[model samples]
Target: MNKTKNIAVLGGDARYLEMVKNMSKSDDIHIELVGFDQLNQGFTGAKQIDLDDLELSKLDAVILPIPGTDGLGYIETVFSDKNLQVTKEWFKKLSKHCLVFSGIANDYLINSVNEAGLSLIPLMERNDVAIYNSIPTVEGTIMIAIQNTDFTIHSSNVIVLGLGRVGMSVASKFAGLGADVHVGSRSKEDIARATEMGVTAFHMNELSAYTSQCNILINTVPALVVTNDVIKTMQSNALIIDLASKPGGTDFDYAEKRGIKALHSLGLPGIVAPKTAGEILGTVVEQIMYEQDLGEE
Candidate 1:
């Protein structure tokens, strides 16, 4: 029995290409590639076509890039020259049963999908996906720290904000590299975990108190945790790596005014390890599709 399902893969970076390749290997998937005409190679079971050519009514699922869309709903099509907009009308065209899968979506995508009565799946929200993603994110953060700092990570005062998945990984890696790692978080359990891991732990309230001696300040929190007050307390030569999403945790304008080198790095997995990231997403998507099929049964 050929239990193939139709999927429309819309604009994205190189990761999408790897994902398509992975999914196409399975005899159960039939892929339609949109906004990817610029790519040289072709997939075995995939058809490259324009957005207009995609029959939303026939699609079992619509796969979008990790970033989903720009704030204005423009899908990120790095491989194509076309400006592909994911409007509400596009969602309206999709079959009511069709699943829309993407990474963290913007408010526009969420509202539009809701209005269109389509199911939107935010893949990054899954614990398996986020934890897997933290690997490449932390690696990229360490890469940035190594490239930007004059001194080695060894014995340096490193403060990692947020005790989330990415933060935990960042703090662990720095500590492994012989850095004096200090984890800042609000949760007492998280702080205790940091201490159990043999690293210093402090509440976020004490962030400013400890910032003055920080050589490498890595922020995984997606809030304005690194404000002007925190920046002012840091050494002028300290390096700040903000791994949160756009408009990151750090106040970039204030950091610059104070002559601090603060970098807001978004989409690290796509940048540093696209193939691995793609494989992770592809695995998760495959699982979701199988689950959906079972639900229908």
Candidate 2:
């Protein structure tokens, strides 16, 4: 008889609730839920248990939420009252063949996983996952733009920084909304792609020249590309929506002092569409496990 694979899901947001549900569908996968005591929903075959109660040596796979862990090694759990720390010592207990998955990686997580000699996969690094995630992110971006701006997206001059997966989608969606979209990027190929998409493309070096006319500025770049100089050039009433990870690209303090509206919106997938995001994650996780030949006799 084939042995059931043991999967441990660590702390996470509402999206993880759906992830637990999706993973529970497979009879061969036995899932353990951690840091979810506050959740009232129940998973059919999953067991809710504390981190200390988990038999770490029996874990076949471990799932950490997006954002992974903080620099101090504490995982994010909106539903938990206690801090869940997955330290290097904790990782050492995992089975040698155990797979670890997270939405993104941090230095602390990378170091810990490396010390334990474990395989760590950051799903957000996958092209398919990133492309799929862009859907909800763009939707949330549009929603925020509409709510924050006084004028319609139609005919508004929108500047999008970066041409990554999310940036490309954001630019295309704004253009589709009839906004005069301008994409700023450091890559010549990305600029060419933006032009082909029927949007104005310009080098990021010339960002200041365009900022004065921008009604809405969206940043996908993780770096501090949207500096005080860039913000100073923008209109007083302009809206800055930064879609990068935490501590976004824009100069928020400067923007606030300048009376410009700036927002750092993170985890839009979980916030705007938890079910869809969770399903996307579930599909990728299952595919990965299959490729690894896991859960088979």
Candidate 3:
């Protein structure tokens, strides 16, 4: 038997606008847009409603924005001025087997979902989403480096910290542009992968050693790898693009104190290419829904 799935999209940017459009194409999926009252564009097959108007007991799922929460329950809303917040109490009201989707999850969200006995899917943890997001991330990194530096990327010393999905793309793209690309990593397999990609690979412990000669230092590691000690060794004219999550990995305070241009670039895909980023998320969400039988054809 076919069943209708009710999903609420709560507090998000332009990407969620496109996601709603994509998800609503399935007639069996009914979407409610909350905290988007100020958005001028009308969502087809979706209704815009205030969060207070939602009947939590009837909802089958909830979709949160990529940035999700700020380690608190406050959601990011660009379209409205309303203060939108969600907590474990709200999650507990949802129907059984309800699914919650977000680009990423913080401690508060993780705890809330666990306590509610609901499933929380952090979509960014998926390999496909990470790799897809890497394209826009690399482009944005190059753009930032170019904008901040007086020298061209070609033949410049570029050191990429980490060899994760995004890090690998950043390294290869820069290497293809004739830059002297060097990748730092703790994983032996990642180091070998960087070497196989024809870029210089070094241990992360040797990061400070390369900073002095590096013209553009890109850190993708989500930890405090670029501390004051590391930034102190970097050239004053160098550019630092930290692609890690919130608060980033770079010591922005010390980098500024040293006069090095450091930028903590987050949500690069949404910033550089919103439609594509949104569609990638939409595709994945649709796939997950179909696989889980959350909705029927």
Compare the candidates by TM-score and give the number of the best one.
1
lDDT of 1 by residue, 73-93 (tens): 898888898999988888999
TM-score rank, highest first? 1, 2, 3
Model 1, poorest ten-residue lDDT window? 1-10
* Per-residue lDDT of 230 in model 2: 94
Error of 1 at 283 (Å): 0.9
Model 1, position 238, has a per-residue lDDT of: 99
* Per-residue lDDT value at 232 in model 3: 94
Local accuracy by lDDT, each model: 0.91, 0.92, 0.88
Off by over 4 Å in 3: 70-72, 294-297
lDDT tens string, model 2, 3-95?
A: 577999999888888888998988888999999989888988798999999999998899998889999889988888988999899999998
How far off is residue 236 in model 3, in Å? 1.8
* TM-score of model number 2: 0.93
Steric clash count of candidate 2: 0
Q: Model 1: runs farther than 4 Å from truth? A: 70-72
lDDT score of residue 113 within candidate 2: 94
Which candidate number has the best lDDT? 2
